[model samples]
Target: MSNPSIIFIPGSYVLLPVYQPLFDAVSEAGYEIKGIHPPTVGLSSRQGRESPAPSMYDDAAVIAQAAEKLADQGKDVILMGHSYAGIPMSQSTKGLGKEERRAQGKPGGIVQLAFISCLVPAIGSSAASLLGRFPNEKRPLVSIDEDGWMLMEDPEATARMICQELPPKEGEAIVTGFAKHSAQSFGNQLTHAGYKDIPVSYLLCEEDLAGPPDFQREMIAMIAEASGRKVDVTSIKAGHCPNLTAKDETIEWVLNVVRKAEESRPTV
Candidate 1:
């Protein structure tokens, strides 16, 4: 459990840079942090093309490769997923944690999974399924083009929903950096449920308009029921983007979970 690598997966339409503060804080606290920018979120002109847009499975494959590399170096990992990125985060870490690798006489496997106001779906479930259940008016914040790519319809509305606590300029920066997300990923079912095997923590953003508190609780309950263990949950009074709105608190909560995971690790 010494110096585990902290890998972050950001939600749809945003890039890894948005979590720079959280990354910096974790780094300053003496932990390595890696951000996985999902290909599903077309962050570059190359990715924005109609032809070669990536899906959730593709995103998970990329993350899984990263985790494997870290595991090969004998470093345990903490995989954190934000928003829609949770799907790939959970799916990617499956059978790649220290315990799982060690069981196979290999090194490096994920030791913890952290969901930050992210979707927690079961095996065979898709993030879109959960999102689709929301009222029609509340859903469809993003418009999906004919090419099966998704984009924010109104940046102002998006900012108010997820970044309401941030300053106008900072919120605008997030909006400006918005990318086109692949619609295929939304409907892709997860092959594995990492939370069922790996230790998990859920950071519930109470003021999240995208993922309401009650819905988060329901997801947590679902996870607990499926896993046959209670999922550790920490609450923050912020919008969807807590890493931006409540940076310091988010860091503390993350570190707290890291410490708990370290303590619970089996001593060799």
Candidate 2:
């Protein structure tokens, strides 16, 4: 593989701009990388107020469309997701793997599915199910209004959880960055299990408060059990929002991933 496109799916309610440093750095290093927004995040589209909220699949469609577009152009892709985005990103890879597309005489396809302190949910489980129903002990809580969008009861506290390593004042500012995302995206059961067929990597945020290290390990174990192979793992001593809290390190780590990916074959 050579210079594969790197597409990153941001966590729920968080917009793509937060990953600007990562994108800029990767691009500067001579690889194409994108940070895309899922339709459910509302500074953009959450449908009309009267319209039903978007599901995880809607998010999945946005991701799939962006990735396969690169694939169609004969560009290999490295699909990575952060936090809640893992669900949609994984679901997005339905028939877009390099081997799968090549089998159909098509060029380009996803070669890597990388998770950055993300939720690796089970098939038939929604991000909400794994989070809402069986959430990690350290995870913070946010309410959902009748319109089905999330409400952050305390953005300050939420920020602290995600950016635990940062100073309280600096972390507090990032609270405004979180948007009102569709609650339905969390509730919807995933119809597709894309990770099972793809080569996978996990960037474990050891100090994560949103999804603790134990939770991260559990998610990694799920893939190993299903695929009978351990996911390639990398550790970063940061909290949930490593991209925000540990920007420089995250950028360096991602660049390394790009270099290795470019040198390797598109095999899982």
Candidate 3:
């Protein structure tokens, strides 16, 4: 059997920094790892500012193209999504077949999905809905600037949104790199979640302020119920980005999921 390959998709308004620790850990565990940079990061407005161009649908299109390429390689592929990227990753694994489409066989092509402190919404929910509304009915995703950067409309507010249990370093990083998100991306609803039926797992960071451990649990329970399979829930005592605080455990959890998926693949 060939070595398994893992694709790491980072969350909203940032590059691969949030995933670096986890990816490094996974690489050390003897699996091939790749980072998928959806233009959603730099293609938007400054952090907590306005968006560049709007459209989560456009983001999904880009992600799906990348996913198809990875899926075509015929390696046991594991798609792991962090934060907002989960929405697109969910859309990427749709309509794949296993073993030439055996009679009523389980869907294949994508082996598994793991969401790291993300909002993996049900088929009909939008990102805006996930974040809820701000005062005066303003949407959080609409605060991008002209150059498509996202920042906290109010730095203090952004701080509060992500500051519950983060360390001083993480809070500083969030202030520096916090970019704006496209309202269109947040508003872009998924037509169907391709990863909905795939075996899935959720990693909850118990001390995370961005997504909060409590919220993470709720999202996991919802996705698990909707997918009609119990999610393999793993809890870590880190902030929103486990790759940073709990790198070793994050990598171990990812490897476990990939190994399980590879083992579950139908043998020829």
Cα TM-score per model: 0.93, 0.92, 0.82
lDDT of each residue in 1-268, candidate 1, tens digit only: 4578888888887877778889888888888888987778776521355565668989899999998998899888888889897889888877796777898999878988899999988888898788877776865366777777887776766787788898777786677677788888989998888888887899999999988999999989988998898889999898999888888889999899878867877777
Candidate 2, 173: how far from true, in Å?
1.5
TM match of model 3 to true structure: 0.82
Give per-residue CA lDDT, model 3, range 142-213, as digits (tens).
Answer: 354665544555544454455534556655556456555554677777777755567787888888766767
The numbered model that scores best in lDDT is 1
Mind giving the per-residue lDDT tens digits that candidate 2 earns over 147-223? 78875656778887888777887776676666778888888887777778887888999998788899899989998
Among all windows of 10 consecutive residues in model 3, the one with the lowest summed lDDT is 133-142
Model 2 reaches what TM-score against the true structure? 0.92
Regarding TM-score, does 1 or 2 come out ahead?
1
Q: Alpha-carbon error at 106 in model 3, in Å?
A: 14
Off by over 4 Å in 2: 44-51, 133-141, 266-268
Instruction: Give lDDT for model 1.
Output: 0.83
Candidate 2 backbone overlaps, count:
0
What clash pairs does model 2 have? none
